[model samples]
Target: MSMKNRHVLGEAVRHLILIILALYTLAPLLFLFVNAFKSNNEIIASPVALPEHWTLQYIKTAMEAINFGKALGLTFIITFFSILLLVIVSSFAAWAMVRSKTILSNIVFLCFTAAMLVPFQSLMYPLLSVFEKMGLKNVQGLILMYGGFGLSMSVFLYHGFIKSVPASLEEAAVLDGANLFQMFFKVVFPLLKGTTVTVIVLNGMWIWNDYLLPFLVIGNKTGSKTLTLELYFAKLTSGQYGNPWELIFPAVFVTIIPIIILYIFLQKYIVAGVSEGAVKM
Candidate 1:
């Protein structure tokens, strides 16, 4: 084939592959959305078929059953505060460690790096034991747990990105009579906008969608349930012997909408932050 023709054919093939991948990734989401509008029998009868009659009946039922407003509020509070704590603590630690440039700092940074590899499963029981002993099986404790579990990766990201940042900017701020807190917060933190958003989006989604951590900390608690836990109990109370696909689908769809909106808005920052952070490391 002519060179131009060959290039055109390759481009066509790449586009075809991408289209297929896109459909594959979106298929489950599409299914979930469709099923949310369907009755249990309809879903069971034709899982892949379009709902014969689209309705908001199931969605409204789910919202009421799951106590959607309260669960959503609790979930938002936990996710928001957890990400806030993670950003503040991790960024400060990363900045101090990077600037210290001491042997001890190096050791600490390496420890954080190694922590990213440690399986949460191994630490889960020990952490629960410690928290229980301290009477921390509550929202505050859950936020603290998120900060700890999320710390390693957030620090790792900030560390890399901070190294790429020119130290002269901070030095100039110091010379301009900026104190330690002012310099770090006003100057350093502002520049980390992309990374901060990236960290928030990454960890925020996890905390919002997470069932395991919340379940462990506050299992089936009446007033403190996150969205995931609400969905779980909603499903449990929905049926005794069989799965409640109708409620499950609608509840899940409702729960995920916030995170999906978040991702849509901040996705560009995620890519930019990861790329910028990776530039130096």
Candidate 2:
């Protein structure tokens, strides 16, 4: 076939495939949104039809059941500080590995690489024992644990980014009598805003939506259930009698809202950051 004809055929096939996939993905979300408001009878009678009476009762019940505000607040507390520690500590660690020129630096970077492959499940018992000994089976302990786990990946990302960052900025800062602290915080650190955003977006979602780790570590102590764990329990409890749409749907939406908002604002950086890492690997 002619080049033009082949290209036209390929374009037509791509469009057809994309349209089918879009429907496959979007139809379920549309179903969930519409069905969350529908009566059980409505869902049973006509799965695709619009809800006869849209309801906030499910949302209200869900929020109340999970204590949405508290879950959100707790999630923010853990994710914010965890990401902060991950960014600051990991960026500098990565920079030193790249620029400092030492066997120790190489060893440290290698250790981080190894650490990244250590699955969370394998470390659970040891972590639980340490927390138990230290009496940190609470939200704070969870945050600390997340920071440790997140550091390896965060450092890996920072390593990629700092490779491309010019070193002269740090050297010039040194010429200007800037100390290590000043050169890092004021100069090199500012340049890492993209990678930092990337880390924040990735780790923010991971820590925020996590359930198993928090549940295993903290075990639903009244004052400190993170959002996902709470949402899980809410869904479990709400399962009887048509799932109490008043609560279940709202919980589902609440669990997802922050991530959606974060992604909306930072999608460009996220895409570039993800693609950069993928291409490097």
Candidate 3:
């Protein structure tokens, strides 16, 4: 074979492998989706094929059971505030740790890194008591808790990323007699845009999807559950295996759609951030 023809064949082989892997990964989702449309008997009979008689009855029943609107609102609120606080608090704390360079700064940085490894599961009771004592049981409390918990990871990422930023930009702002706050907002922080976008996207997704912490902290109170919490209920039931999968698929799709939209819109930023982390390291 000619060299060019040989290269084309190699590319084709790689493409075929990727296609197979994609289908393999997607198979379960496809299976669930098809079975969702099938009746219980039909689903058992044809687990992998399209339903012969597609119906909206299962979807309607699921929506009624799930209480779609209420569930969605609850999820949105939890995700929004949690992400907001996680981003703001983590960013500020990270900026201070990396930029200040004091003895306390080193200690703060270490504390966060240490906190990340501290196994949050072990601290569940203590954390709950602390929040309860502080009267943080509501959404505000939940946001603050997410902020604190997410801080270590966010700061760790931000600290490393900010360290790679050139300090000369801040020095130039200072030369013009800009105050520290002004200098940070206008000059230093803005320069960290790439890193900031990266942190936001990363933390946003994490906070949006986390279930355990919120479950413990927020409880199963109405109007406070997150999408993750909603899905948890859908995943299993007490002594029940007959629940239709289609009932939960719509809610699952709702949970994921935001992340999909975000990635589509900011894919370049996300990719650049991931690349920069390795290069900086």
Candidate 4:
């Protein structure tokens, strides 16, 4: 074969592999969607088969049982505030660490970076203990917990991006009489948009899909239960031997809708931010 033919063959093979992988990843979602419209008997009989009739009955049942509206709203509130606080606090923390010459600042920054290695499961019990003692097992409390747990990586990303930022811009802001908060917010923060988008989407997805931490801190019984926690309890009454595919699948579908929409909208930002941050790092 000629060189051009070999290159075309390689490109074709690559596209074929990509298409296969995409189908592999999306298969479970497709299965869930198909089964969401199926009755329990139909789902059990032909798990991968398309439904005989698309019906909203299971979805309606799941939504009503789980109080889908309330859980979704609570989840949105927690994820939004958690990302907002994480970006704001992590940005200032990272910027200060970059600009400050103090040994303490270095130590604190090192501690935060080191914290990324600590598994959430290891600290789960003690963290819940502290929260329970202080009566912090609520939506507000969960947001704060997310901020703390999310800080390590957020600071790490911000720190790397901040290092690439020229100090001259901040100095110019100071010359214009910008105070610490104003300098950071107006001058420094705006420049960190790429890293900020990276942080928000990264942390937003984690906080939104989180189950263990929220389940531990705020029990599934609470009015503040998140969507994942709601899903957990949705199966409680299904008995020991059997699964409630009808209710469960529809609830699962409903639960993921918001995050799906969010990703579709902000996927461009995610790509751009990741590329920008990677370059700076």
Best-performing candidate as measured by lDDT? 1
Per-residue lDDT of 206-229 in model 3, one digit per residue for the tens?
Answer: 777777777887767865666677
| TM-score winner, 1 or 2 | 1
Over the stretch 139-253, how does candidate 2's per-residue lDDT look in tens digits? Answer: 7788888889999888888887777778888889999999989998999888777777889999998988888888987776887788888877776787652455545555777
* Candidate 1, poorest ten consecutive residues by summed lDDT: 234-243
lDDT tens digits by residue: candidate 1, 2-117: 99999999999999999999999999999999998999999999999999998998898898878999999999999999999999999999999999999999999999999999
Best by TM-score: 1
lDDT of each: 0.92, 0.81, 0.72, 0.86
- Point out the higher-scoring one by TM-score: 3 or 4: 4
Rank list by lDDT: 1, 4, 2, 3
Decoy 3 TM-score against native: 0.82
lDDT of 4: 0.86
Q: What is the C-alpha lDDT profile of model 4 across 1-281, one tens digit per residue?
A: 99999999999999999999999999999998999899899998999999999999889888876779999998899999999899989999999998996899889988998999999889988988888889998777888999999999988888878888889998999999999999899988998887888888888889989998788777856687889988888788644314588889998999988887787777777777776655665
Q: Which residue pairs collide in model 4, if any?
A: none
lDDT of candidate 1? 0.92
What number of backbone clashes does candidate 3 have, counting pairs of residues 3 or more apart or in separate chains? 0
Model 1: residues with Cα > 4 Å off, grouped in runs = 240-243
TM-score, per-candidate, Cα-based: 0.97, 0.89, 0.82, 0.93
lDDT of 3: 0.72
